[model samples]
Target: MSATERGESKIRIRPMEPMDIDRVLAIDSKITGVRRAATYTDLIIGDLGKIPDLSFVAEVDGEVQGFLLARRDYFGEPFSEEGMIHILGVEPDYWRQGIATRMVDALAETCQEKKLNAVRIMIDERDDQLQSLFERSGFRRGKLVDYTKKFKK
Candidate 1:
């Protein structure tokens, strides 16, 4: 069911602004434990500066509850536009209230408006809750491996 069908009221989704950095950082740090405030600052300012429509925040009762940052890029191999959901976080107290789902649906709507070929996101293999959430959102598993290599600084 859509967010509206689930009786979501007093919850508003709007384009993220630079003034939202503090609350966004707090939510991100609380959810992920990665407290690098500068990183989120750059992301919010830079990404929104480029494509304002790609970033959004979910607010309830005028308080920021969650946020999603996404970007669109064009790939050349098959020549297609794609949308990537880079980051997402919802407050612990608001969990299971379909806040993230609503944020994603909003992003998907923007992607559709931009004519993106697909929307993608990377989730940790052990995150069953996230996996289930995306699955319920009509996302299917794809055959791909996420590899990483760290270099000494």
Candidate 2:
């Protein structure tokens, strides 16, 4: 059945609530195979508390099928702001159903409403599927390079 025929005429997207933490962690853990409950708790409770509209979930038939967690970031000497999509995940069964795409569109709309310069995300170079998703959603490569360092005990 088509998405419309399957009663998904509209994918309900809404801000992530504190109650959504468990389901969010489940979905994230299912994808990454690691349950970082503390990390998600901070995002759902702390980050969402700060910028409620930036994080969202996709619901179908009243079940939470996917989620996108984003935040507002400021950088550069002049301090320009942008929306950053930190994490996105969908139920394994719902892959290729356009849930992620819709969530991204919702985020973009929110960014525009907030007058942010742009929306950005960092995808692993090897993850072609995710790269394609962002590309199809109108995201392009930027000049910024990501660097990380780990502290030794």
Candidate 3:
């Protein structure tokens, strides 16, 4: 269903601005246990290869309630470009409100506009809610198992 089909509450979805970095950081920390607000800014600027308008925010009442980071990339050998859902978070208070689905739709539209081959996402094993959302967005688990390593400096 479209956002319009889901009723209207003045939800404004738009690209992220410098002013949104702080709230985006807070939301990221709350959802992911990552607290690198400074590094996030740098990574966004120096790495990520993200287009300015593809990273977005969902707002209501003039406050940011959600954010989405989408990017397009190529594997070393693959001669094709694919889209990635690098990060997405909706404020805890706004859970189960379809904010995520809306963000996914927006990201998909952006990817299509840019002629991406496909959009992919990686979700943590424990986040059932987000997993459900991904499924609702037509994403299925691929053949790969998710792995990560933690290091301390």
User: Best candidate, lDDT-wise?
Assistant: 2
Weakest 10 consecutive residues, lDDT, candidate 1? 44-53
Give the per-residue lDDT of model 1 (tens digit) for 1-153: 655446665788887877886788788778776676466535655754553447889998789999988777665576678887778889887888888998888888888888888888889889999999999888888776777898999
Q: Per-residue lDDT of 54-88 in model 2, one digit per residue for the tens?
A: 89999877878898988888767688898888788
Residue-wise lDDT of candidate 3 within 1-153, one digit each (tens)? 655346655677887777787787777677766665454534663445444456888997678989887667764354668777777888886777788888888888778889887788877879998788989988888876756798999
The Cα RMSD of model 1 versus the native structure comes to 4.5
Worst 10 residues of 2 by lDDT: 44-53
TM-scores of all candidate predictions against the true structure? 0.78, 0.82, 0.72
Task: State which candidate, 1 or 3, has the greater TM-score.
Answer: 1
Greater-TM-score candidate between 1 and 2: 2
- In model 3, the runs with Cα more than 4 Å from the true position are 1-8, 30-53, 145-153
User: Candidate 2: deviation at residue 68, Å?
Assistant: 0.7
Candidates ranked by TM-score: 2, 1, 3
lDDT at 52, model 3? 47
Model 3 earns a TM-score of 0.72
Task: lDDT winner between 2 and 3, please give it.
Answer: 2
